[model samples]
Target chain A: MNLLSIIKRFAYDLQGLTFYSFRLFGKILSRPMYLMETFEQMYFLGVGSLFLVVLTGVFAGQGMALQFSIELADFGSKNYLGRVMVIAITRELGPVLCGLMVAARVAAGITAEIGSMKSSEQIEALRAFGIDPIRKLAVPRFWALMVMLPVLTIVTDFVAIYGGYIIAVYIANISGAVYWTNVTAKLTLGNFIIGLSKPFIFAAIIAIISTYMGFSTVGGTRGVGRSTTESVVACSISILFINFLFTRLLVPQIQGLL
Target chain B: MIRFENVSFSYGKEPVLRDVSFHVKPGETVVVLGISGSGKSTILKLIAGLVQPDSGRVLINGHEMTTASEDEWSRVRPKIGFVFQGGALFDSMTVGENIGFTLIEHTDKTMDEIEVTVRETLRFLNLSEDLIDILPDSLSGGMQRRVSIGRAVAAVDPMIMLYDEPTTGLDPISTEAITELILKLQSVKGVSSIVVTHQITDAFEVTNHFIVLHDGVMVFDGPGEKLVQVQDERVQSFLAPFMQSVKNIPAVCPEE
Candidate 1:
């Protein structure tokens, strides 16, 4: 209830998550790879989420292009729509939107699944069989999300840029060639670095927070629901906060490097 | 063989097990009796190394498990199979996969060989081969419990198997069948066991040795017949309700 206690709980959660991430990293690098399970997770998470990601990208790109075109028209340079769209979509909105949306979908599902397993004693059963649940259950999801998020980000970036193309060329009456040229003009290495880095970081954060909430679930079905809700909320807040830090701190540094 | 030496455990400030001690020799069966929250399952959990004691010791096959690392416990764990009361099958996995999980994870056997072993395990459990492809949720409680046992026994010759409330929620026929299956495993595989249950008849049917726990403390430990003779009021009270039910049963039916 108090701010101090809240801070303490958050610190405690971070500590547990750090240890969990360490153990996960150890298992992921070592022997006993669950390649089939990893591939299964990829298909489930990546392919399963393709539609959602694409939809988010489309609306984001279209809206940004249209809004920027209207603003630039007052300055007699509506042609700058594509350039502005590319910068906003690729550098900031694309990865962040994709991260948050996927985090919403995936984090809840992971927590619910693993939380139910925890309540059912299935988690304990895995350990009793001489298998670590982290290695068997969490490892596959971790690797899957790690691999899938970047790939999904690419899909999102591509779809978003295309959506910008549609809005600029058709709705805004900008020439396709000029639109694409402006889009490429803003596609700097700095932009790519900032855009791509967030998803991987977001992936790690989502997997760690969701899986941690899951394993720590206490009660029964009520516990499962509570943890699932907390997993999504924590993941969304963490993703947004990290995105802010990434933009504020990393962007200037990346721009300096460029 | 499994042995506990004055093992005490508490989930929080409240102790779940208080200075409990017992031993199961190789190829022997010991039934642990207790009501809900009486620490019967905790004893089994301790032996399985799922939880360590707050004080004292747990020796599983000569290793002091209280101090064992996860890796050490992993090495020793496969020798002990645990059957949770609720079956605890992986719902995502089908019945065959559940039974073959251990082999699939730990053994070098091919899928075909594993399938054969699963079939053999199902046969040993007296379950039909047709049930292998179904999900665990679809099966009756009794069938699920049997499949759980089959899964435990499917992989290796488990030196010790721990069953927690194995017949708690089954019909009389199912209860009798589960008790018989436990007996069958002991007779056929020579597997040692510690069966936990509040089902007095099923507990009595499964073993000669009995250990009773009340309020997180061991109330009685001795042969099954001697359990009734213990002057402990807590032990008598624990058995009182089940005893009345047993007494009401007619010795012979009219048809007999």
Candidate 2:
């Protein structure tokens, strides 16, 4: 298929899966809630994702610092490294990159595990036993990512800035006070908020797309691989696209209100 | 207790089941025998309300599966259990956790009570206590099957047990063990069963009634022994291959 047709097919499939997920979600909360299952999913989707987020945070911090300091050093303004590092990390890299990392780690894991369960008829077995798969499996993980992603991004943003600051001051021989002053002067609450905001939506998108892909994955190992690939690619693209749109729509309004 | 009347289903437009009609009376064990793609397992899904029929109706205890409310379906579902082909144990969970999943999800049982119940059920399945804490990924095929069966039984006392190709991947010994377990569950649990399989001996050993589907249509409905003596030429041709291969398998007794 051509690119346009592929996009159209993807949109249609995504819309249908979204509708199905919401419908099942409604049923999940109505009665006979799987409270324990939800808790279990939360642990799987949230607690297990910590190390990945932390690793991404540390690496992103150090890398951004190194790149920014090198660039600023040419202009004899290496002291401004912290300001650039903070802005890029918080407002762009923190949420977006962290979301991508999570999309790669947790989203793929969710998709593969759930997809395997689905192909193996374990989902059908759940239905046969009076359990709603959404309530028992999907929603908790969905909400877990939805809740955890933003928090993880915030942590990543802080860690990244700190890592960058440490590298700029100690390794790159920039003055600590100058770096602090530049970052503090350029950085605002708005930037932090802006950076942190995207993760909730990003998390939601990742959870929805990944869960849907996993739940609907057909065939065997090939199918699981395809779904996992689709999940990461689709989630990352959606996160960036929506981040741009959200910035255009919400950022101006928030600036106006402030 | 379960019935399908003129039910039709298709995946996208290719028909998988066409005008299929069958019924399992209360507490009766019905075996559905067919070649792959014959819509045998689809019947279980139809009855369990997993897939809505494209046409006609599936009635479980006089309520249409498609029209039943969520509450109604939930109320009905607990009365049935499905054991899938590959055991389908939650890989991340231990054997005890997998079995206690249903109890934990749907019941108000305390941890202590659930632990007791899980231990009791494991013992009932002749599983060692040491197996309880091991992850499902560590379990053998027969052990996995037992754990899956244990999970299915944990929710409530199922009045109907559905087995979808239970013996598909097992060795002869394991197959015999599963077949005997199916029989024991029927007799001891006093539950109805609908098993879909290609294994003739499995059909003969566990099910009293047999339903055969050919090309998505019900071709025969009778006792298990009658399958061997059916006058239908198509049925005879279908059995011809199994009959030829039956000699290769020794007439071993059912596993304990």
Candidate 3:
């Protein structure tokens, strides 16, 4: 298939699964949900990804603090270091970097797991059993990623801000009061929200890309690998592209709104 | 009953199947025998609606495969049990869970009811109770096929069972077990079956009707014994590779 046709097919498949998933969710809510499966995925997709999120958060915050201090120090505006760090973390890099991390971790896992299942014909078997693979496989995962990534991004923002505070105040010898003052003064609700919205979009992209990759996998073992790799690469690329789109299109609107 | 009329499928510029037409009636096992890459599995996939034909039509019980709504297709999907060549049992679940999947999905039946069904299906396949609790990995090759068969028949006794290369990679004993299980599934479950195999022995033992696909076209369509009497040189050459693989058969080629 040509690239456009392939993408069109993928989009069609995604739309079909999305509709199917919502229908299954209606069934799920009517009866008992797969409580145990949801919980396990929450732990695996959300909780297990915490360490990487926090690790990336801490270092990212420290780097931002150091960079802002060094740049603004030359202009005798080092006192504004905390303001820059907080804004940077809360409104942009915090969510974006964490999203990239999750694209690597969570998105890759879902793709590989589901892709392997597809290749092994487990997915076919599920269909034979009257189970919609989209419901059993895709929906639980999409819901997990959708709910978890945003929460994880929030935690990442907080952790990054704290890391910046420790580095700017203790290591850079900036006054703690000045740091807190600028941060409390400049960081606003609008900034927080602009940052928060990116992860929701990123989570959706991750869900779409991973589920698409998983469901479309052909061949056998090698195809699963290709799908997993494609999920991560496609997700990371799409995240960056979406980040730019949000920054260009939404950030200025928020600034105007505020 | 499943019917195909002038069905054609192609990937990109190349055609995999062309002008294929056939009907599989209830309670008959139809074996599609072909060389590797002959599109035998593709036929099964088309019947299951996993892939659409580029031209013509496929019907299950007189219902068009192409025009069915998603919910309608989902209902149709359960009636078609597919045992993939690889067994395709979910590795994440235990044998019990794999077999119980259909019950869990379509019905509001209790876990107790589901478990009873799973157990009875397993027992019918002559598998022991110990195999139920273990994961699919712990089972032998033959046992996995049996478990997959059990899972295939778990919830809705399918109107049609499709076996994709049922004896592709198995020891003689395992192959025999699979063949017997294939027979049992057809006879007891009372479902029409389509088995895809390169093995002539498997085709002979497991089918009454046979369709030999060559270059994605149906070359022979008749009773199983009629396949042996065909005067076609190409068919004889195709049958040559698998002939020596059969064990303990008489010298008579075949006579109906």
| Candidate number with greatest TM-score | 1
What's the interface RMS deviation of candidate 3?
A: 1.7
**CAPRI tier of model 3:** medium
Question: lDDT tens digits, residues B1-256, model 3?
Answer: 8999999899888888989999998787888988888889999988888778999899999989866776788878888888888799899889998888878877889999998888898888888877777999988878888888888888787889989987777898989889889888877878999999888876777665788888888888887555666887767778776657543333332333
lDDT of each: 0.88, 0.81, 0.83
**Model 1 misplaced stretches (Cα beyond 4 Å):** A1-8, B245-256
User: Would candidate 2 be rated incorrect, acceptable, medium or high by CAPRI criteria?
Assistant: medium
Q: Runs in model 2 with CA error above 4 Å?
A: A1-8, A24-55, A66-79, A171-173, B244-256
Candidate 1 collision pairs: none
Interface RMSD of each: 0.6, 1.2, 1.7
Q: Point out the higher-scoring one by DockQ: 1 or 2.
A: 1
Q: How many steric overlaps does candidate 1 have?
A: 0
TM-score of chain A of each: 0.95, 0.88, 0.87
The superposed Cα distance between candidate 1 and the true structure at residue B16, in angstroms, equals: 0.9
Q: How well is candidate 3 docked (DockQ)?
A: 0.55
In model 3, what is the error at residue A65, expressed in angstroms?
A: 1.9
Instruction: Tell me the tens digit of each residue's lDDT in model 3 across A1-258.
Output: 899999998788668657744654465444335666766877888999999999989888988888888889899999898888878887788888989999999878988988888888788766655566766676667678778999999889888888888988888889889988988887788887898889888987787778768887888899999889978988999899999999999899988988
The candidate 2 chain A region of ten consecutive residues with least summed lDDT is A28-37
